[model samples]
Target: MAYRGRFAPSPSGPLHAGSLVAALASWLDARAHGGAWLVRIEDVDRPRNVPGADEEILRQLAACGLVPDRPPTWQSQREALYQAALDRLVREGKAYPCACSRRDIALALFAQGRERTRHGELVYPGTCRAGLHGQEARAWRLRVPEGVVPWTDRRVGVHLQNVAEEVGDFVLKRADGLFAYQLAVVVDDADQGITHVVRGEDLVDNTPRQILLQRALGVPTPQYLHAPLVLGPNGEKLSKQNGAAAVEVAQPAAALAAAARVLGITVDPRVAVPELLAQAVRAWGARYP
Candidate 1:
């Protein structure tokens, strides 16, 4: 497959240090393997997007000398592919309609003393799977097999999750027709022919759901690597909404070099972009540590 890899960033805001860490890791891994590095703006959830944020993200990457092999791809332009994947899941009985709402599911779980849903969304009871529809509209959920989500992670060790038991049936396409991240990511990865996925650790739990979707649609799954979460000075994760500042695109070499240091690499911040990339490639090869 020639080791094709992708850096998919959501356009919620400008690139933050956390985002830069993810991008740097994926870029180094792809380059070290002599693979193609690609970019995809995951603007599927349009509500959170900032106008012009996508362009700003690309500009920041360019400043960091992390140019993708091909022109950048956008998720908003790929509705048909997502639809096809959804249709296949339904036809194969791998997914079904769910009518549970946030409140209803929460109440169901409160009765059981469970504090949170496995995916952090309310744990869905099998309320809609039996052809029973509530008063509200229905969203589609994957009929996750009653077993563990078996897989391995490059960063996290020995990954497993029983989606049926832990996460419950997860939504595929929301009632408003916006595809779930699980569905969209699987479709896009297959569509782009991604052979390896090196991203942040926050997505490690979501990997199982994605793997299920991939198997249901008969898409070849990519190798997975989840990096550590970037924490704030308060010990919380850094996020755009949490006031994490944008990666200084005006000084991208500095941003890239800083991210490398944060990831425990001993490279100098003043290294040129090209040489920094080469050093990064060598560092990544020593161990994904």
Candidate 2:
């Protein structure tokens, strides 16, 4: 099969060092294997989206010389596809309505002393999994099977998850009327004919859920490689919410060098954008092991 990969970014903020690392990694992976590198704007969550973030991200990508092979796809415009996938899951009885509010679920988990979980999120208690009728279900969750789903992550080595224990039935559509990332990503990947998924290691845990959904929805499972994360100076995830993920507005070259360093490349600190990208891609492709 042809190799196809993508750099999917949510337009909640500008591209930070961590995000640039992910984008560069995905771009190198696709180009190294002679594959098509596509870009996808994951703007499904309208509430968190910042104004002008999408166009700004596009400009940043162009500035970095990572123009996509095709016009970028926006998840906001693909509601029909996500809805169809959700309906199929519902019809197959592989998904059900979930009425539990986030607060209620959190309190219940706390009451049960299930505060710590493998996925770091609540391992939903399957509260509405059985015999749940629409009663204004605020969300819909895909039912995870009882057995183990195993896949080898290209960068992270072997990975295994027992869905029922790790992530219980996961949300497909939020009660807030937006499709969850799992559902949207699977549908988009299948629709775009993507064959390889290169992303940050943080999403490694989500691969099983996505694979299960792909099978249930009759889509092909793509190969996955979860690259190492780029932590901030505090050794924590650099996120806009935390203010540690911000990019230096004055110098994108510095940001590119920082990203390259995070990816383990020895890059010249003052190279031009094109030269820097060429060096980074060649170094990454030849040395990524």
Candidate 3:
């Protein structure tokens, strides 16, 4: 596999502090392992994508001296790949169409005397697992198997989850005719030969579902390292939705140093961007090796 790693970011906004932490961590991991570092624009959710956000994200990465080894991929242009993967799942009976909407799922859960999970995610009741029952199909969902799926995180250590019991049969294709993140990410990782994934801890919950998708699609699961999240002033995960400001790359070294601090790798912010990143790579190797 040659230790390939990637930093995939959605094109919803420019690189913010939290996103830079993820980007820096992934770049560090790739450099530390002497691997190829790649980038991918996760713009499959067309509605959320800003018109020029992808270009701005690349410019931001370049300013921080975290350029990819190859030209970045855009999920929006790869619908055929996702469709092919979904088709295989459908043929294998691992996926099926669902007619349930948000309200339908809520009502089904209520009937079963169940409430949303602690994370506030509504667990689907598999209402259309048998068939759509003549109702028009609204989306496609994977038929998650029963039993705990155990996986290890390089940073967070061991974790276990029963996808069937917890997440239920999650969507592969959404009602809006867009491919779900779970499916697009799995397919992209496999297609890109990504051997490692380094991102924020906020996405750690998504790992199990992605693992399940990898198994269903018969693709290799990459090693994961979830970096600590950078918090906002309100002590919440920093995000564009919460008005987290974009990284000011006018001073590249300072920006890179701030992100490195989140990864527990302190470096001289006064140095040039190249030297600062070099120091970061060494520190990261020592800790993560």
lDDT of 3 at 43: 98
Model 2 weakest lDDT span, ten residues long = 241-250
- lDDT tens digits, residues 104-207, model 2? 78887789888766646778878898755656678999988889999988777788888888788899999889899999999999999999998888888789
Model 2 alpha-carbon drift over 4 Å, by segment: 103-120, 245-253
Candidate closer to the true structure by lDDT (higher is better), 2 or 3: 3
lDDT of 1 by residue, 137-171 (tens): 56888887788878988766788888787788889
RMSD of 3: 0.8
lDDT of 3 by residue, 1-289 (tens): 7999999999999999999999999999999999999999999999999889999999999999999999999998999999999999999999999999989999999999987763777899999999988999999999999999999999989999988888899999999999999999999999999999999999988999999999999999999999999999999999999998989989888888889998999999998888999999999999999
Pairs in steric clash, model 1: none
Candidate topping lDDT: 3
lDDT of each: 0.85, 0.85, 0.94
